[model samples]
Target: MTSQRAPLEPLVPHPRAPVVPQASIIPPPPLPPPAPASGPAPPHVFGLEKSHLLKEALEKAGPVPSGREDVKRLLKLHKDRFRNDLQWILFCAELPSLIQEGPQCGLVALWMASTLLVPPDGVPLDRLLQVALERGYTAQGEMFSVADMGKLAQEVLGCHTELLCGGLGGPNRDYILQHIIAGHPLLVPYDEDFNHEPCQRRGHKAHWAVSAGVLLGVVAVPSLGYAEDPELAGLFHPVPSTPYQPPPLPEEGFSGAIYLLSKQGKSWHYQLWEYGQVQESNLQLTDFAPSRAMDGRAYVVPAGGVRSGLCGQALLLRQHDTSH
Candidate 1:
């Protein structure tokens, strides 16, 4: 007998076919607006409160001698002490007289500031030089004020930075001390011939050095330091065994100023900063008071804030009559 073949199942649609929803024409709700960015607040004074304290600092700021003989004497007097006192020191490798890289004290200062602030995205010195050159800051070459360099930095770094004029007795002495305490390195311009010495080369024009830090009570040198902690003391690698003594207080009328950069807070808030330049007269005199020129104020970058280029209007006045 032939086996019965299985009957073929008749075709039938499933009772539960997948349902298809009709497409809606309504649009999704719009996203919420972004939160506004916080910016620097108003400028305020920090550290010293009394004006007389600044006056005393000015009076005590002795004149720095420039003659090769005086510089040798000063270094001789302080050599052993500098190594013993400061935790570390910094000296620029480029000297204005020797370097063909244009007047680069300001550029060096910008590098120091970038290093000190330790910004995660800080630019390198060569990049800074390129940006500065592109920005026309180096047009005047070495004659360009530290203020101009500061302006260039403000743009490149996207922050507020400025140049403050005066010396030991200058009006902004108090202000300079305040920022240092707040952990800002100062770009000090001094008569390269008179104030800065022991460099491979020295010149009649101004030179820049970074005031890396300030010693609270132990005063062996001026406001800057290379190493932050006293316990980790060692000679600065670049300028090993070199003695750094700030020239005596600047003369009554000085031309250069300290380079300062403004810091942005989580919100709107800014700090003010200053100091003055070195004078040719300071090289000759040892007993003269801080110059009146140091008292004059100079603002090269005005001030950039949280938002980029906020201080654009302030920078319209680029060159200052810095020849004090």
Candidate 2:
């Protein structure tokens, strides 16, 4: 008995894909449009105009007064207030600073903004959460939509809101300086670098804060406490309460200087921090660039060592219009 076998057939290319001589020459399939990201929609999605311009102004650097005395002096910041600066208190419209338990920075920021109204509001955190609920801002009652948070400020606090974002954690310095100096309290949506402070040393979280005003060249932050929150019970950074030394007299000698080394092309430009202000310096340490400058003679802070959650994204909370 004998069996018949089938004949071989020629290969053909699919009509959609043309044959290429080599697999390497063939193009890969187009990637699916990135799935709508899990977080809040951008400001443009909520109908805000956009523009392009220069925003490079930075704070005038100054010696933050070297001492183991205060926590503000530790962060390479020329000046900042931890909890109870009179200026920050006034800037917060006489409202108390807020602290979040767990992850409620956004709600705390909104509550602070509410105080700008006449008779001084006391918008409860629960109300803000309710707003978040109605706006679909939160998923599972924790994470929130930054866009909706902006809307929450406007809707709940009754203020005109203008949103801005830097994408990268660092914002346009001018935007921070301009809005803060102009007395517009900004509700900034940011990521808390847990490692920015000593105790929490690890990850980052999507958070928010109130930039109450500018305190001594640095942006004054009044709300959303980290180091100062007692409720956390040492789970977070503790408030620095050691005695800080007062400024030295002329005979006591100059304390030292703060230098801001900004990267320019392949080299770094040195900006001198003088008398509590940043001044442009033509300082040419040809042999000692910032990359090689850190040797403990001066307290050295690298570019990566500094970050600000507030400046990255802002929702400016303009004072409520009394005329209307």
| lDDT, each prediction | 0.33, 0.34
**lDDT tens string, model 2, 194-285?**
33111111112334445544322212323343233233221122133433222111111222221111111100111112212111111110
lDDT of 1 by residue, 1-324 (tens): 121112212222212111122222222122224435577431221111224554354346433222222323423555543334333222221111111233444554455456444354245555666665455444222312444555555566554454443223334454454445434555544434332331112123334444433322232324433333232333232223544443233233432222222221111111111222222211222211133114332212212210111111011111122211
Backbone clashes in model 1: 20
Please, what is the TM-score per model? Answer: 0.37, 0.40
Q: On a 0 to 1 TM-score scale, where does candidate 1 land against the true structure?
A: 0.37
Report the C-alpha displacement of residue 119, candidate 1, in angstroms. Answer: 2.3
Best by lDDT: 2
lDDT of 1: 0.33
Off by over 4 Å in 1: 1-102, 118-121, 140-143, 166-170, 198-203, 216-324
User: Candidate 2 — worst ten consecutive residues by lDDT sum?
Assistant: 45-54
